[model samples]
Target: MTTRPPGAAAPATAPPTSGQTPEQAALRPGLKNRHLSMIAIGGVIGAGLFVGSASGIAAAGPGILLSYALVGALVVFVMRMLGEMAAANPSSGSFSAYADRALGRWAGFSIGWLYWFFWVVVLAVEATAGAKILEGWIPAVPQWGWALIVMLVLTITNLASVGSFGEFEFWFAGIKVVAITGFIVLGGLAIFGVLPGSDHAATGFDNLTSHGGFLPNGPGAILTGILLVVFSFMGSEIVTLAAGESPNARQAVAKATRSVIWRVGVFYVGSILVVVSLLPWNDPSIAKKGSYVAALDSIGIPHAGQIMNFIVLTAVLSCLNSGLYTASRMAFSLGQRGDAPRSLVRTNSRGVPQPAILASVAFGFIAVGFNYLWPDTVFQFLLNSSGAVALFVWLVICFSQLRMRGIILRENPEKLVVRMWLFPYLTWATIGMISFVLLYMLTDDSKGGGRVQVLLSVLVAALVVAISLVRERIRRNATQDALASR
Candidate 1:
């Protein structure tokens, strides 16, 4: 840590709303605690966890659970830092605003834009996923039609009001929560051989070690599993970002971060455990079908796969909605801070950022056209470019909190409601650990052109730096010209 001057002004550390103007502050107290709580719950349980755990298990066997645990721990650490920052200065901009204040204009510019990129990419990906599931259910409709319907419907809901979006998400998240709870309940019963038709004798804890032993490929596989499954937790932190728009943003951040572990850890580990236990790693259906629905179907539930596809569809839509909202909000914030074009600062009567909405829609349309054309090239290009941003965002959160913490401790320690454990130590460790993870990913086989993606993301970050520098110079020249005229 760098030393600070004895009398310099430290950044204030009160909760996030401390920085928002009155107008922005009045947007909406519309999202209730229930909505936020469920958002936190549902955010952790994305389509990836339900359908993608098979890939992790295949890569690492039963040791995949350890992979999730490592990532979960890292997320918990990162969220704690984010909570500390959000508690002090919750705003619609969330970490972007924090980055601007604590780091500098360029850090905020780069990280904020990178995050917007991530969400936009996510918006298209979720829309596509939702479309595929809907097309399966209604073959008469083309997949692109399903994507359009999904986007426009959610777009209208979001445009209506914050309350409308929150309410829509509330029910969608409710369905997911109930379904996952039911899954755990049913899987538990089957595990103990209590279910009505639980015929699999290998459902007990013995399965953990029986199949070529627990670490089938050795302890190294657990690390490999982490490489595969860490991305599944990507959407979870979006809750804190979204919560900045809620009433009592600081409290929401604290509460959401406090409970993140249980949501990410239990759901991930619990679900994956039940999965490998229910069926052997080498089972064809695990690869042929998927891990989530297949696990339910194995327990004699009729149409479990279809039911799960529907649930996964809901998950995808929820993500698309949130993705659109997040990207737009970031763009709106950037415009407000002079990092983007001024037009995005406009808001409709409903306080919706209409320009931001249109921008998001424009990107979605591009994704739509790409999907219609050569999806493989476009999707791969988008995925690879945005692949490294999550780490970048996490790194920003860590640095922001590191600087924000001291100012907070000195100025108003009482307001530090949701503090990171071990503070400076854990904060530094998280930064280092994440650095190592990035390095590890560079060498992973599954990365498959990850290097190019990482390289391009770095270039994007550099571009932001260049723009910020140019903007600052222009602003200074204008100021000098005005002074000379006077």
Candidate 2:
């Protein structure tokens, strides 16, 4: 069951099969190796890493480094499982397709729609954040106007051609990779007092331990930091999804999964180590300015705040670009699986799923409007409702892979190009860890939004499950009626 590479001439609608439909043939394989490589490299570094880390440091002190390491390891394990299944069978559906085969229609439909909801919400969040920055810089266009403008531009790019989206993401992600890598190099040199003209205030490992010790707030704070920083890692799985559109999807997914370990280690843990070592965790500058900017200032970089603002803006745009692409693909897959409107599976002359793209962006724009109309009440509910969805998606991937691996071995052993480490054991461990995180979210309300997010996400998941079951029942009843009539 090899997937037909995109850009190849799609055959006229084939006779629909019982298990799968015929509409999975139109997406173009316009994503190049460079686009995928940069997306993998830059996906882990998000706007959260730039602007959100200050709070994490304040919570866990220098020990926040350990929180990153813990979460980074969890992501690595999850991606390894996802890569194994993806290498065996790549689809625009990605994990949703696997869940359908391994679990059932309800599992696939529920998870697919949930994942789509997660990204659409992200589209609103990132757009609003980016708009504020653009408005601040230009001051001519208002924030709402900027949000509309940004969404419109990216939507056009996505509808134009898959390659255009790939090219835009290539440069957007490339800027982020360069910024973070430059920060790591410059910050590391400054920590050792080797960078010329660097600020001499508080350099070396002493900064890590000198300020009330490494676990300044206490060992318990690491869990708090974990909750704070884990959401930043949400987009790391985009590489596997993007790989489905590559020419050699199996090889691409395999390569990306293998490389993720070192990338996360270097870009995340290494960068944080430099930040903590270069300046004390309790530094007033870290709280006032972002951690990354404070690190830059410590190294005598002028206009550190303005420089970081540019990088953060780049990150927000990159996220919006990827989020739209992801949501549209999910919608297309769901339609092909008969869980969504069939129209969503239709593609344009350029092999782009124009209907799906528009549908996903329409919801995103609506969310942005709601954000403007009711910033504190209605919009905040929307934000919290989708907050814990990333964890839910990861948990499904873990379960899907577990079932998929056994079926692969029994049915098609040769297709196993990538395999999860420690097979069933680590697979089960990953599931347990994810469940623990969700349960922890339920018990902990101190984050101001944690409990509400978990409860609302559960409520959303339950609603999706109920809808899928009801739809299945209705279809089954209709089929039986036709048979009896015949």
Instruction: Compare the candidates by TM-score and give the number of the best one.
Output: 2
- Per-residue CA lDDT of candidate 1, range 260-361, in tens? 889876788887888888877767788888887778878889888889888888888778877887888888878877888989978777667888878987
What ranges in model 2 sit over 4 Å off? Answer: 1-24
Model 1 spans > 4 angstroms off: 1-23, 445-449
Per-residue C-alpha lDDT of model 2 across residues 1-486, encoded as one tens digit per residue: 123465665467542222122334467677888888888888877888888889999999999999999889999999999889888777788888888888889999999999999999889999999999999899999999999999999999999998898899999989988888899988877877788887555467998899899999999899888888999998888887777667767777888899989988998899899989988899899999889988888789999888988999999999999999999999999988899999998988887999999999999999998899998888888888898989988999999988999998997699898899998899899888888878877767754467889998899899999999999999999999999999
lDDT score, residue 144, model 1?
88
Question: Model 1 TM-score?
Answer: 0.92
TM-score per prediction, in order, is 0.92, 0.95
